[model samples]
Target: MAPEYLLWAAVLYVGAAVGSFLNVVIHRVPLGESVVKPRSRCPACRTTIAWYDNIPVLSWLALRGKCRGCGTGISGRYPFIEFITALIALVLFARLGLSIAFGVQFAFSCALIVVAYIDLDHQIIPDKISLPGIVLGLLAAIPGGMPAMTDAVLGVLLGGGLLLTVAWVYERSTGREGMGGGDVKLLAMIGAFLGWQGVLLTLLLGSLLGSAIGLVLMASQGADRKLAIPFGPFLSLGALVTLFWGHAIVRWYISYAGLAEI
Candidate 1:
């Protein structure tokens, strides 16, 4: 096997391990539980999960997605998240190679996974992740990171402020809240990492994706916009897309529009 393949495999293994920890974060953060302590256990039987049984995707397959202690069914999402996280890491590695950029973006990606899942299950994005993320994003820029320091700062302000203004306008017009604070902060954190341009692209992508999904759900279920679909997952996905393909996307849009690339 090529040395490059060996390195890629190592990254995949590390990414899956990190994803396993992310599972704990997603499950515990929203519930106000400590993710660090109280070693992983079977929720059904309260048996501590041994290290061998906790091997990311393989253990779940070996156990057939069941708790070995009590034979209780485990959600497939566990292995799914691990696999997806590994894939995302591999993609980032391929794109950015082994550098500070990869480290920053990978951490940001992991946080997004945590935020996305938590929002999906609980309709909330925890400040515990976003607030610190904002700071971290800003710091990441110091090391020749994405978009430079100035862009990152602007991303924070514009990202948070743009959504905040829309939310305010929406609430005033409808006499009801249309957006959550969590979404705003999540975008802000995205801006911190991707910069103001990223914020715009992420918003456009997220809105388009969310709107399409919303229309489908409403049509199929005979529900309305009041159905309360969580937006964090869409936004997280958009951010990931932007991180990976933002520059190419920008160039394409410019060329397609017959505008000179800036």
Candidate 2:
């Protein structure tokens, strides 16, 4: 293989390793556990995982998806997360090459991966992730950076403000908390990374995709209007889509509307 391909392969491997660590964070952070204090261990047997057994996807396959000490079935999510992280890293590398853009995109992808799973499982997005993410995103938006600072600031305001307003109105109208504070923070994080344009795109695309999923779930008797669906995952998806294809999507929409390009 070419030298560049080899380098990317190494990067992907590292990303997979990071994904394994991220799994620990995702699982423990929400439970108010220290992700750093404890080394990797099998949840079933509470046995410290040997270095070999901790290899990202390979270890899962080698162990036949079971704990070595107790033969308990391991969660498939471990390997799945590793695979997704590797794939995302490869994609970002291909798109942005070896640059700051690559780092920002990779960081965003990793955050989304953690947010997606955590929200799915617990319906919560920890301040540890979202709050730090907001600050990091803004820092990433420094002038001449991946996203301009102006854009980042606008995104932060638009994303957080819009969600906060909607949540407030919904609560007032219904006399209930309709949206979680976590959702607002998550969007703010997205805006910090993607900017105001991205914030708008994320909200638009997220709503469309979320609505479709809700409709499908309702039709299948899986969910209903009364059922609470975590909005963080859908917002993450929208942000990811915007990160990669925002410009093209915006152009296509404008052209379809018979408007001149800005």
Candidate 3:
């Protein structure tokens, strides 16, 4: 009932609204459709969604995940995305408060969410997001920003270079393309925001997470060894982890490896 609680609630509400918009981005961007012109609608029936029916998680719950006009089942992913976006916003607010840092990180996180979902659905990370993101990340790294500008520049180079090198080597060694250019750009964008150190950690974390999940899918589902899984989501997850705990993680690793003095 306190003012802080009220503030948090407002933050959550706004976050969910943003998420709703993000859902539009995720759905429409890949198809080259304008996200703003067309209002939200029930894809099943082509009926325009009413404002009340479009309320973040609540509307879906009210409608029981079905179209009000047609009773067609709506994907739960809509609400899930909304909820996750809200949670991400809350996490950022809690960590960074209402500061420039919060705004920067929130925008970065939203981009990741959009990239991740788009890649999952289409196996492609659109340049529309990552290319501009690289520029924005560098801008965010200006004085009093997340990472120092020098670090951000290095991050761009190293992030792009590291992935590119790996992708090139992988293709040459296998005589097949093993990675996409999108992954390289995505990392570069991450570097712009988090710096070269963050990029390194993000790659380590993303690769490990991707490999582990891949192995699980192969084992549990008897999936193909050559199963083509999209890597953007994993990278996004890694970036999020780094954004929140990169410093602590690095310190822990240094102590664990007895490399604190190295």
Candidate 4:
């Protein structure tokens, strides 16, 4: 067997490659564009990116975050996402190795990254990612894992149902749609992978983070409390945190609240 560190390096490389692809997914999925066809090109000049220039973060850094063809400044986000993906792979590989758990969580993390960024830009969570994500999450459970199939199934139901209910309630009370259908689907997709407990945690954490940021914006820039803000990134952050340290976090919370015996 390969040394553990070597295996980790390989996983990180694979992660970087997937991150590169995810960049494409983030850009194209919301626009109803195909990710597979049409080679990566410079947006400024329509020049096809060569293999050497497409080496994920490395290529971006080497090119000084500029389009090699047009000399236009490229987004630093390209390299940042690749680095984050590599870091994620390193973490998951160190924790779960190359087993089914690692593969399943990797896919889950990739979806989160894509959906988070796309929603940040467009405020929409495309069904292309979330719906299939729901099915894949359930299927991953069928093979035996951390999240039991029952847990995954319940997570999907609870995640989607809870949000739908909230959306319904808010609309009735406020006479306006407070949340989009995309957020509901996004949470459902998260539940499919992380389970019901994860869904609960994501809701709590996402709400807290979203509200905190919203308040900060309002206080600093005169933003209205009702100003629209994206919630998917916060949910994504919560799911990722739960995936790595949820049990410990839950236990800590219970103990802190003097409910450990319960």
Taken over the whole model, the C-alpha lDDT of each candidate is 0.94, 0.90, 0.95, 0.90
User: What TM-score would candidate 2 get against the native?
Assistant: 0.93
C-alpha positional error of residue 77 in candidate 1 after TM-score superposition, expressed in Å: 0.9
User: Residue 251 error for model 1, in Å?
Assistant: 2.0
lDDT of 1 at 229: 91
Name the regions of candidate 1 deviating beyond 4 angstroms.
260-262
Q: Which ten residues in a row have the lowest lDDT in candidate 4?
A: 138-147
| Candidate 2 structure quality by residue, lDDT tens digits, 1-262 | 5788789889899889889988998999899999888798878889998999999999999999999999999999999999988888888888888898888879988998899889999999888888999999998878788678999998888999999999999999999997999999999999999999899999999999999998888889865678788889999999999988999999999899889754
Better of 3 and 4 by lDDT: 3
Against the hidden true structure, what lDDT does model 1 obtain?
0.94
Q: In model 2, where do residues sit more than 4 Å from their true spots?
A: 260-262
List clashing residue pairs in candidate 3. Answer: none
Give Cα distance to truth, residue 248, candidate 4, Å: 1.8
Cα lDDT of candidate 2 equals 0.90
What lDDT, from 0 to 1, does candidate 3 have? Answer: 0.95
Candidate 1 lDDT over 46-136, as tens digits, reads 9999999999999999999999989999999999999989998899899889898888889999999999999999999999999999999
Tens digits of per-residue lDDT for model 4, 1-262:
8787787778889989999999999998788889998899999999999999999898998999988888999999999999999999989988877788888899999999998899899988889889999998988888566589889989999999999999999999999988889889989989889999999998998898888888998999895867888888889988888888899999999999999676
Choose 1 or 3, whichever is better by lDDT.
3
In model 4, the runs with Cα more than 4 Å from the true position are none
Q: Residue by residue across 1-262, what tens digits does model 3's lDDT show?
A: 5689999999999999999999999999999999998798888899999999999999999999999999999999999989999999999999889888899899999999999999999999999999999999999888878799999999999999999999989988999998899999999999999999999999999999999999999999887889999999999999999998999999998999999777
